[model samples]
Target: MQEKLNQFNLLKKKSEKQVAIGLVIIVVATLLFLTMSSVGSEELGQMLGIIVGLIGGIVALVGAAGFSKVKRTFKTEVLSAFFSEVIPGTDYIPDRGLAPVEVYATEFLKRADRFHSEDLLKGKLDDVDFLSSDVRLEERHVQHTKNGTRVYYVPYFVGRVFRFTFNKEFEGYLQVLEAGSPLTNRDFQKVELESIDFNKKFKTYATTELSAFYVLTPDIMEAIFELEKRNPGRIGLSFAGENLYIAINNNKNTFEIKMFRTIDNAMMEGFKNDLMVIKDFIHTLKLNTKIFKRK
Candidate 1:
């Protein structure tokens, strides 16, 4: 009896079973009512038939629509919650009415506007307070530039007080943007943002965050952040997607993670062991340029 009850609970609430049952009843009633009526009542019989048919159709349509809405709502709410929990210093800023072409046009206009207005606007930085303390930072680290690339590294920690300034370009245009991005100008379009569906792949209570940076443009190199969090010791890395992906999660403070892809075989075979021997791990990250192309 308990198992049967669980099965019933799993059934979708707006199932068409009720509609189907109504339809069956309508059909049986129409046949019986028509057969029992007198021969001269043809017009009355036709009116009753049409009414019954319309009623049954409306019932089925309503039930189907209700079920569909339930399914959609369930999926959206779950995904929204998952992303909210995993992204640090991030909130759901939906890109409503933002298509690729619209985004491109807006970006182009922004650049053109800034270029045109540079002379018109004197130094306005003084007007901005920046609220530096309100600005949160997590981990902080410096990576040696290689191949004209800047790869900043941060531990798997979420911080509330790290600071890094960008060139006037970022300060100029990005400051105007509603969503502050970690990528530079040319690479802004290529910035990777991904969210995992834990419910889709596994019956787990946790969802994963996946974001990667590629070397397509110089600006992308700027996506790297130096984090200085409230609890530095809680930062850690988890292995996932083999050598293709590395995930850093901040378990101690807030539920947040940053995932990135790595170049294959970039590290020496004994690199982990060698770093352990020297009490250091690979302090830099590297990526290929081709990976960022639109998929």
Candidate 2:
């Protein structure tokens, strides 16, 4: 792990140097072009400007490609090392293939017309089954132009979703979305829970009010609130059958390699802490408390 970290740092430093050189070249070219333009040689200045711009552009492209390569290498190595040495028994799959169609049937994800999942981390922790993945869902919007209709794919949701098996089966579906979320269903009416604070932060919708109250005990509500406080992202939750799905609206890729920054122990620790938040969900939510038993 140390060797891999050292290699990543070396590559990062080298990439930074290249980017610095590229920027210097572009700045110098711009200055020269302006100087030539001010000298009143119009044709000559234009020609020189074009030449210098092309050269600078090429150099910048090369630097960007080099940095991109180095970043990819560093991310691959460091993530592998982290999973192996730091969080053993967990496996990371780069491409999680297609997300299940059933996910779109959920209340919060109903807007998703196109879906893709990646960076999947699936494993069992202390007898609890869980799967975490970065999910990107898109919706198609058609615009009628003069020539033809243009189809544009806009992001419906780009975030991390954690799905874990619940200890007991649920008779009906229950969804708790962040306040003012767009997704809604007429079948699932809004449920007002006993906790005013929880109701303020979240809009609960369920097939039945009885099921909603049964599932969202006071302790569970407090745990959810605490989780939201710690992670300030918009959270969407759905409980159905024997599983609970949590979707956190965070667009930033987690555990990614920084191009100009060194991967130090502090950074690694931060990554571990983030992972721990996901890993500790079972304990934090008290999922195995047996509050809801199978019918």
Candidate 3:
């Protein structure tokens, strides 16, 4: 993520420089034109004005070039950031020192292939019985006691959904991950292509905890566009005072998770530690059972 931020910073700095330079050129050209046309000599002043006009035209050209360059650069940065942050199983640090966790879930209402069929759920849940299963999840739920239960409210959706969130310290990592690496766009793309190991990364840092719940019910595609429009890029969805948000990328079939800091520590801690539980709960939904009820 640091790399991405660097890239963005580099591009932003370059843009600022170009703008400054463009303005300077314009100012110089205008000043020269005015000075050359002083009241002393009409012929000389006329020649001076012509020279200044040519210089001013050059300045205009430079200004336009600079402005266009910055515009394109900014656009690339925004798109690159969006993809990096929204992609499932990817974690990044933003420059502001905030750390965010992103989770992605995908579903298919109609089981067309093995990947999206009942067989898929059966295979994954071979060890667990589906005869009777249910749990209560809410803010009042006990912490660290429930084996397969969580206190998050999952969303309603079909196809796939992703969640992404971050703590204050990890902000820089996010900026870097989402923004792209200044060193190389190829490197940034490679990061996006790779898979993520949540446990491994979790152990490396003293991360703040946050939780986000998501639900995908097959016909979720109808809500995908709205989700994208409402949340846009890597930013998390705001639930009440809880900022731990979600990001959904349908094109790549990925989702991102982020936690806002305003949440109480206890709640954040519960969400962070119970990640596996949440995962299990999400996995269980793939089964054909009316037993799973939302609290």
Candidate 4:
């Protein structure tokens, strides 16, 4: 992992230097264009300025592309190393994810016309079956302007989705959506929790009121609060059938390396602590022994 990080840092520096070269070229060309008229070479300067500026633009675009290439490679390489060394038996797919059929089956997230997912990881640890991937759902929106109609993808959700299957089975459907989130089903009736802060942060909906109350106990709510604090996104929890679905909406490509951001202890901690969230849920929610009963 450290070796991969070292390689990434080196590539990061190279990409930055390439981008800087492009920017410097553009700046120098602009300055030369401005001074050409003062140097009594306006016509020649105009031609040279145009040529040099175009070259700079191409260089800058190529350099920018290099940054993107570096990010993509870093995610695949460094994250692969993490999965192999840190979490054996776990499968990691950098360019693939859950099918649209599987995502829609959750019935807990908004369905969009455009859906993309990647960074698929699945494994069993301590009898807990888990699968997760980064998902982004976006609907197509058109903007009409003088430049004609421009198509834009408005994102509905961009974060990681987790699915866990335990021995226990839950009755009916209970959805705990973050407040202000737009995902909901007609079958679910909204219910309010006793904690004002919890209610303020999360909006609960369920087909079975008793089951909702039973599943979302005070301590569980507290645990969810703690989980929210640890994560950098909105939390969505659903208890349906025998699986627990968690959708975190932090709007981040979690695996991608930012070339501009320094790799520090805090950042390295996050990188090294990949997939610890699954363990946290197992311990905090007690999924290992989550059995249901009639109230």
- Per-candidate TM-scores read 0.26, 0.86, 0.26, 0.85
Q: List ranges where model 4 is wrong by over 4 Å.
A: 37-46, 194-197, 261-266, 290-295
Give the alpha carbon lDDT tens digit for every residue of 1-295 in model 2: 7787787788777767877777777777777778888988767777877777777777777777887887666556567557655556777765562266545535577646677777777777666677787778888999998999999899867777888887766588999888877766547878999999999999999999998998898988988888888776788888887888888886756666676778888888877876776666888887656645544
The local lDDT score (0 to 100) that residue 162 gets in candidate 4 is 87
Worst 10 residues of 4 by lDDT: 286-295
Estimate the TM-score for candidate 1: 0.26
Models, CA RMSD each = 22.6, 3.1, 23.1, 3.3
lDDT of 1 by residue, 156-227 (tens): 222211111111111112211112222223323222232222112111110122122111123322222221
Cα lDDT tens digits, model 3, 155-209, are 2222222222111112111111122111211211112211233222211111112
List per-prediction Cα lDDT, in the order shown.
Answer: 0.28, 0.76, 0.30, 0.79
Q: Candidate 1 regions off by >4 Å?
A: 1-11, 22-42, 83-295
Q: How accurate is candidate 3 locally (lDDT)?
A: 0.30
Score candidate 4 by lDDT: 0.79
Best by lDDT: 4
Q: What's the distance in Å from true for residue 148, model 3?
A: 77
Of 2 and 3, the candidate ahead on lDDT is 2
Which segments of model 3 are wrong by more than 4 Å? 87-295
Native-to-model Cα distance after best TM-score fit, residue 7 in candidate 1, in Å = 11
Candidate 2, lDDT over the whole model: 0.76
Compose the digit string of candidate 4's lDDT tens values, residues 147-178. 89999999878988888874455578888888
Which 10-residue window in model 3 sums to the lowest lDDT?
114-123
